[model samples]
Structures are given as C-alpha cells and as structure tokens.
Target: MRGAFSTNKTMGEAPEMFYVNGFAKVVPEVQPNHVNNVDDSSTWYEEIIDDDLKWSFKLNSVLHKAISEYQDIALLDTKRFGKALMLDGKMQSSEADEFIYHECLIHPSLLCHSNPKTVFIMGGGEGSAAREALKHKSMEKVVMCDIDKEVVDFCRKYLVANKEAFADKKLDLVINCAKAELEKRKEKFDIIVGDLADPLEDGPCYQLYTKSFYEKVVKPKLTENGIFVTQAGPAGIFSHKEVFTSIHNTIKQVFKYVVAYGTHVPSFADSWGWVMASDQPILIDAVEMDKRIEERIKGKLLYLDGAWFHSSTIMNKAVSKSLKNETHVYTEDNARFIPGHGIACRP
Candidate 1:
C-alpha cells in the first residue's frame, strides 16, 4: 500500500523539490511547460524521464490552475494529489474495476430507491459518472460539475472509451468550482455523487472533506430520501483497508446512515475505497447489477463482474481482524495521520 505525504525527501540534494515514500519517490518535475494535446484527444509530456515507475510533480501546476498531461494519461494538480485523466488500459474504460467504482457510485442510490430521476455529479468531468448515471432508463436529468475545464476538454478529445457515456443529450456538463456552483443552484437532486479527491487539506478539495462544509453547503441540496455518494480514499491509506470508514463516520454524524464499499484499481496500491450515505440503508445486489451491466454494455472488462463484484464487498479477514484489535486515532483538529500502520482516523 502507498503512504501519504511526509516531510522526508528521497534525494538529499533536492530536499524541497521532492517527497519520499520509502523506495517510491514523488519528485517535482513540471516547470513552465506548455501541454499541446496531441492527436486531438490525448497529450504527452515532452520532458524526459529516466524511469517510468516513479511519480513526478509538475512544478508549474500550482494547486488551483495546474494540469499534468502524459501519454495516455493526464492529471489536474488540484492542490492535493490531483485528478487522474486516463486514456488507456483497464483504468480508462467503464470495464471491470473502473466499472465497479463508477457503477457503485451511481447505481445503489438509484436502484435501492423507489424514485430517482435527477442526479448531480461533483467533479466527474471525465464523464464516467455522468455516463453511468444516464444508464438508468428512469433518470431524467444529469448535471455534472467540475472545477477544471481541461479535464472535460481532454476527455472529449482523446478518451474514446467514454463516447457512449457522455453522448447523452440530457447531460448538463458544468465546468466550475463544485462547492461554489452547488451553492447557487436552488434545485435539489435525487442523488448526489461527489467524485472529488479524499484529502481533508492540501488542495482546493479541503472544504469537501469537512463535516461543517457538508452539513451547511452540501447536505441541504439533496432531495427527500435522496442518497449521497463520494470517493473516499484507499483502505490501506485511510482506515485499515476500509478507507471510506473515516468518511463514513464523519458522514454518519450528518446523514442518517453511512456505509462504505471497496474496489480494486490497478493504478492504486491497495485498490480504492468508496463511501455511500443516505437516510436509508442501501443493500446493493452486485449480482443483479452485473446482469444489468452485461445486458446493457456488452464488453470485456478487468476488475468487476458478478463474482468479483460480490467478493469486493466482503471485508478481508486479515484487515478486519487487525483493525478490530487495534485502536485508530482521529480528530477534527488532527485529521492527518501516518498511513499504512493499521487505523489512524481515531487519533
């Protein structure tokens, strides 16, 4: 499992330029570089890199107006770790694990409820969430809000995997700061999906992680019996292997019920985590969803299906037992804790 940011630097000579996480080094690399989106849809970084395994930070990409363009990949440096724009591989399409992540984010709220027609997406400019939201034949309107315009433009240009998902005429794509944009809209949504980063601080995403922010700014926007969902963090990095638990506990304080689920992403070290909360319980039948996915979109995928999807929800015995035996510490005052050492949200 990968760890969060610490003060240590891998290279002693460039202490301020890089951050170290054991052997995996994340160093600053972006400096006054202009990205020319190649082949209309995808872009490549002209800067030379000796190794492909290491992560590099784009210096010019400040927290607000930063973007990273790589071959088959792009990242918006939104202060924290940034948003990933995938063009190729299992991570790109709505197949397997990626499908599970996006489907779970959209479906449970819709299928579990008696009525769901309108949906709002916060920060899924790549169109995956918007695409999945449109899958429901009952859904009437789909609103998408993302801070960076570059992500939407890049997806429309190069990511063909999302062509079917975003082609819907009912989709309303809004390129604006999600927090501020959602504030102005008087209309509430039947389901609200937040695809933003999980960081409590570090980037523009800090506000989204706070309970005060959600209660005052986000919660009231939901329709009656409306369900709210979002991407939390990795279990290994946040709460044992159930990273969304921290967000789950936080949301439970605000909403009526909060539950978390997991998915294994190839790009992430210990897969990824998701948090879904509502005034009611969400009993997702992955088996049924799988049949629907197969009937709806007939394609080969990497991480999700009936079997894998069902297995993902089952807590790993090792991780579950470890967490139960150990005490994890977390507080609103000191939310940030060391990663990968059991649970740290309680301290």
Candidate 2:
C-alpha cells in the first residue's frame, strides 16, 4: 500500500448469522459505551489538504483506534463536534452534522428518478446512506456492499445514530468488494450510489471512479433509466482542481447527462462535491423535486429540498469553468486523489 487513504462515509455494522467473508474466526468486540473522555494519547488531530495547507480539530479523547486489514480506524470524542469517525487518519463524519453530507449525497438522485425502488450503494459502511434510502416509501431493497468488514462492524457498534438503519430489513449488507458484488449480480437497480471513499494512490477505491468502470461495470448494472451518483471529493475554489473536476469529466464520458453539486461540510473542514449522472434526462425543477420528496420519502429533511437542490447545482464561477475546461479522465493509471490524511497531534 502507498499510504492510508481517507474516505467520506463508508462505515457500518456486524451482521448476525451472516457469512462475513475472510473471517475464519470471529473477533472479540469492545463495548463502545465504555470509551471515556479522560483517557487518550492525543488531544488534537490534523487533516492535511496538501503539503502547505491543513485543518485541525480539538478532541476530548481518542475513543477507539486500531489498524484493520484494510486501513487505520479511529473513533473520537471531539470537543465540539460530538463523536467523530476517522479512517486512515482522516475524519469521515461527525455526529453533530453528518446529516448535511448524507442528505446531499443521497436524496437528489433518488428524487430525480420518478420512483427509485431498488438501489445499490458501493461503500456507505456507516449505514447513513442506507438510513436515508430506507426513508423513501418507494424503496424495495437497498444493497450496501463494502470491502471492509472491520470498519463496518466498528461503525455498527459505535455509531449509535444509525443503529436502527443497520437493523432495518430493507438494507442488504454484503461483505465484498463492490465491483465483484456488482458484477456478479444479475439484477439491475433504479439507482446505483457510489457512496465511496475518496481515491488515493494505490488504494482499491479509485478504479470505481474511472471512465472504463462507468462504461463497463456500473452502467450495465443500472436499469434503462437508472441514475449513477458518486462523491466527487473536494470542490472548493482552492481544491476543486484535485479530484472533483476529473471525476465529473470521467462520468461525463459515459453518461449523456451529468450534474455536479457541492456543499460545505463542517467536519470535513472544506467544501465537498458529488456528481450525479445518467443516460436519461435528470430533470431539475425545484417544484417537482419537492413534490417527490414529500410524496416518496418519510420524515422531514434537515437539508436538501427542491429550492436548495436548485441552488446547489449552480456551481461557483471558478468550479464551473474548471469543469468545462478539465481534461483529466479518472483512470487506474491516470487518476487524481484528494491530497491529505489525518495526523495525530504531537506535544
């Protein structure tokens, strides 16, 4: 491995009586309830944006830290952000405001489809994506396939907010590489979500973002009008050039209609991007979208309704121009990755 890569929100629960792949024997569980604020080896953490820039956060304690077969994991109690989950040194989501990121990543594509019944999530191990998808009355099945069982179980045990979601019968949690799981299945879905981690050098997640995979594996698994959506890394004025523009361009190569939207996520400490694409027309009428949200989904949305949906798609001038001019197509050999990992503080 080149180094540990950061992800947005691929975390989840351990299954009962389910065959967990690669587990010859079950591992012992540590109760998350026992994690205390006074015990820790670090008081702060850093998110490296690049060589010259970074973001920092203060924490009450290091709740849990470990190295799984796939990556480094940390569960933290932050001073202000409630509880935070970090993978490979990068914080994924915070308890205080993860709803913002999850809502934006999921709702637009589901609402865009006339009635999205079946959905496939590539890597939302945290169960937040599944939690959001199950709220839709039209949803029949939501399959979540993540490559790592360690992180999934970790999230399931500690992320108490998503407890009900992980237990929901609608979610079919599969322990396998998304590519392998997706390709093996004969069925197609109304929406296929790339609730995946940001691409990093030598990391296993980048191939799913490539043009060839969209044209080959992903597109074929979707229904005729199926929509494919993915998290497109950083999209701020300073960071848009990194992976967002390139991911957008790659999806554009395979789909006729592509829309890129962004929102500033506080825990991420930067603006984030998500790209939604489909071979069919993705209508953007705020009124229609609002109507669908009201009809198809249960409960009130904390963020992302028709009016906000309309505005979020309107990318900034620099990012708009950058998307139009970006030439990079994400490929296995030629891909751009978000350039930072989390680092524990030193005293």
Compute the lDDT of residue 158 as modeled in candidate 1. 48
The TM-scores of all predictions, comma-separated, are 0.64, 0.86
The residue ranges of model 2 lying beyond 4 angstroms of the native Cα positions read 1-42, 341-347
The stretch of ten residues in a row with the least summed lDDT in candidate 1 is 42-51
Error at 292, model 1, angstroms? 7.0
Which is the leading candidate under lDDT? 2
lDDT of each structure? 0.57, 0.82
Per-residue lDDT of model 2, residues 1-347, tens digit only = 11423322223432111111101112223347565344333345555667787555666767777766666677878887988877765667899999999999999999999889999999998889999999999999999998879879988988898999999898999999999999999999999999887886545587889998999999999999999999989889999999999999999999999999999998887899999999899966999888888888899999888989889888888889999999999878887877643222111
> Could you list the CA RMSD of all candidates, in the order they appear?
10.4, 10.5
Q: Model 1 — TM-score against the truth?
A: 0.64
